[model samples]
Target chain A: MYFFQKNKYKIMLVASTAVLVVCIIVGSAINRRKAGGASDALGTVFTPLQSGVTGASDSVSGFFNYLTNMKGYEKENEKLREKIASLEDELRKTDNLKSENERLRKMLDLKENEKDYKTVAADVVAFEMDNFSKSYTINKGIKDGITQSCAVITPYGLVGYVSEVGRNWAKVCPIVDSKVSVSASIMRVGNTAIVQGDIGLMEDGLCKMTYVSKETGLEVGDSIETSGSGGVIPAGIYIGKVTEIKNDVTGVSQEAVIKPGVDFSDVNEVMVIKDN
Target chain B: MNYVLSYLTLAVLFVLQTTLGRYIDICGIAPDIIFVYVLCYSMYNYPVRAAVLSIIAGIIVDLYSSTHVGLNALLYMYIGLAVSNFASTLMKKNVWTVALGVVVLSILYHTVVLITQYVIAGHSGFVYPFVRIALPTAVYDGVVSLVLSLWAQWLSMDKIRGL
Candidate 1:
């Protein structure tokens, strides 16, 4: 009888607690529902309190922020002053580029009078992410009348030759290709060299100039440009500058190491020598 | 009236689980309140009644959680049935004994969530998942279970008996 009574009491206790939990759940839910319905009361009460406190705090913060921000402004001002100096330097560079472009334009105009030299501007797209394949995709393709064997040139010099042409995109196998050749002229001494793209030397960002005599006046930093033979690229379009001249024991032909003007990787714009 | 309160409590617990629960995160997890609550009620109540309550609680949890339609309802109902049958062995008034209820339910809930998440993600790692997910959840629920169980006891003694 005692054990049964204790069991009955335990049952009652368990039942009541379950009821309590159920009640808490129900009460909170109903209260929340009721609170949600009383939007008018909440709007008049909570919004004003929330917004007023926020506005006041924002104003106070605005004052302190202004002071600290002014100190920041001084640091910013010093930065801005340096940036202004740098910008002035950039403007001078732009002016220099414009003057150089003007002289190149005159030279191009003289070549234009002579014959099939026509130019079309094309935009560059992607390149191999990490390869020394000095090639890039251009926006102009077959649709733009760009066909294979057309030379890609920059105002600075020979870029590449159009290799693949789709309706909208074209690929250029640049002067860096081992099979690629440019008849280059050493401008000062009028020495002629067959500039060949050397795959082994691509890592050093260089192309090769073969057949130049070792005794030629071509020195380090001497410029090389297309000689315009066979109407490939016009004569005097800056190809590259000679950096090294190698004379071997077999020395039938000395090779002048030419670094092309166009990095090819960073070339964003180019001119296609379509009619040239 | 009772059903209304039970649903309300589940909702409140869920809101707490998502919001205030974020702060209570000990090391980046919190107690499964619904699980602890389910455990306690299931153990103390009649087996059939526990099943019914568990269904309701599971549905509420599923609605609030990202769980698919009837998963939580089914899982918790089974837990309710199991716990109620187990609780029959001891007098429900034993506070320490009810704690074991909390542990069982915590493990069940965490396991269900893990399975559900894995099914949705379509990846199954090695076995003994509960050793990682469920174990920590069990610890969290154990603490919550102690507090809620005490409150249940106080309510049972102070006002429930008189009422």
Candidate 2:
């Protein structure tokens, strides 16, 4: 009783610390098992609030952007009008080519690979606040037929894969996250490599591709795409282009730096591929 | 300050941090507003209350983020305890001292995060992140903490004096 009275605060702190340490161990085990009961409950409550706040902030930012770029919009409109005229002429040629390609595909008995996957579009409701990881929450979730490890993409290119899913929301961890690694192939040389995220390159919106063979002959601006080695991500989804190449420290292989096609900072809407 | 009101404010700030914090990011690094608030609150409140608040804050962060649930909870609890001890021993509690504490604690927080990442994930290249992300964030948090501590002091002048 005397000791307890004399050091009540210190005792409390020690007890709390012990409890927290246990929680850390238990929580990490749960996380590894991908059982996110607590996270899902919290997400159900917070997702609506996040969606509302995101909508309001987007409107505010859109209004400001309109005000600041009025002149630029006028110039862009003029250029787009001229480009539309040329595109219309090109569309006629594309239609003819499409019909011819369909006939050729029928003759060769080839399937339309692009139609194999269905996608659900979702709006980004929130982003990770810390500097260590690159992830965002999308408004669509398990109810929308989204599942863990589903591939996320924009029209531009691959964005990432679903890391966690809740009833009404899911978190997408991008290719640039330190823990994500993708099996990729170089378009020109047709050689495969592993594109892995590095903490050093994440800040610059870049990732590193390693395990390249010595004879791969990688060059600047070589297109990289998913190799379909792992069935999670679909094949031939454009990931990035090589910007720099270097020899491995062990002199047995090479690595290259990649700049992803989709600029994550401005990504608002994403399509989550389903039934993959 | 009323504990209920303080917690409510923290909740609001956390919502804003997750939603609008990216807009204010400087070169892809966002200031940790929740951290600054907890540090300042710990300076003025009892260690036990501060610790409880820290655990709540940490749980909120862990629930929202993709990390394991208790990683941030453990980190924040220790930080809250340390800040409370530092404040109680100080000769005077003011904006300058609180700001300094924020800078120091910010560094400690990021360092722990980096170490944890290295240990758990086997992430390589420590110097790059320490130089690029950790140091700039500490300085940025210090500047924001200065303004926030000043505003908090102004709001609860009597409470501060009593402390």
Candidate 3:
């Protein structure tokens, strides 16, 4: 009893340290299985708070952006008006082509090549605070039919996949994260390749497409799209355009750096593809 | 009362770090205000209290940002203990000393995180993160700590009696 009283602080320190080590082991196990109860509870509590803070931050940033770009908005508005008129004209032509294509498909008895996917749009509430991984949290979760490994995308292109889901929030690991790998194909060459996040290229907002055959000619401007071989992400989703090509460390395969169509840093809203 | 104020301040800093921190990032690197606050608090408090608070802060960070739970908790506990020990030996605490503590610990923290990442995840290429992230973040955190410590000194002399 005397010893316990004398070394209470030291005992507490040691006990806490041991508990943390055990927590690490248990946390890793739980993470491998899926989001655990502790993570879910944290997510439930923090999601609303994070959403409110993020909304406030966005408003503040938006106001600052408006102030800084006030002079350019007038010219931008004018340019956008002209672009809208041209796009309207193009839309009419596109509508006609779509109907003609539909008739041709029916006449040819061709099955649908593309599957219409059910999607849930969610607002990005917060981003991972560290630099190690490229991830963000969305306001939608399992309640919204979002599950682990669900493909996340924006209008521009593929964003990433759902890594962890909470009650009211989910963490999205972007395509640029080192842990993400997508089965991709060059749109121009039709050659399949593996698009993976590289630690070296992550800071530059780029991913690497590897496993390219030497015979396949890859150009700097070649577009890449998901091939959907994994069954997790749907096929024909635009990923990015190739910006650079380099020999792999093994010197046997070539790798191409890809700049994704979605601006990951600026992503505010995303669509989680639920099912097809 | 002091402990309550400290925890409240830490909570506010946590909120800001997750939200406003992204907007003010310099070259995709933001100051870890949570780390700075924890370090500062450790330097002025009991080692046991510092360690406990650091664990709480680390767990909060892990819950929000990390896939695993205790990596940061372990790191922060050690840092808090180390900083407490170092501070006890010091004759005085000031902006420069606090900034120095932040810079040194920031570098140590990143290095440990990188090594842990490499060990667990097989993530190679340490030189890039060290050069691009660790070095710049250390310097940036140092500057932020300097500014914040100075502000704290200006705000209430008794709050940071040593400073």
* Best model per lDDT: 2
lDDT of each: 0.62, 0.84, 0.83
**Candidate 1 on B1-163: residue-level lDDT in tens?**
5545555665556545533343365543566777787777665566666777787776555433321435566667777777777766644456666676687667666665656554234433314345644677687788788777664444324222211
- Computed on C-alphas against the true complex, the DockQ of each candidate is 0.02, 0.70, 0.61
Error of model 2, residue A42, in angstroms = 2.0
Determine the backbone clash count of candidate 1: 3
- Summed backbone clashes in each candidate are 3, 0, 0
Question: TM-score, chain B only, every model?
Answer: 0.78, 0.88, 0.87
Ranking by lDDT: 2, 3, 1
- Candidate 1 residues lying further than 4 Å off, grouped into runs, are A1-117, A128-132, B1-163
CAPRI level of candidate 3 = medium
Local lDDT at B40 for model 2: 80
lDDT of 3 by residue, A68-133 (tens): 999899999999999999999999999999999999999999998867889999999877776677
Worst 10 residues of 1 chain A by lDDT: A31-40
Q: A1, model 3: CA deviation in Å? A: 1.6
Locate the minimum summed-lDDT window of 10 residues in model 2 chain A: A26-35
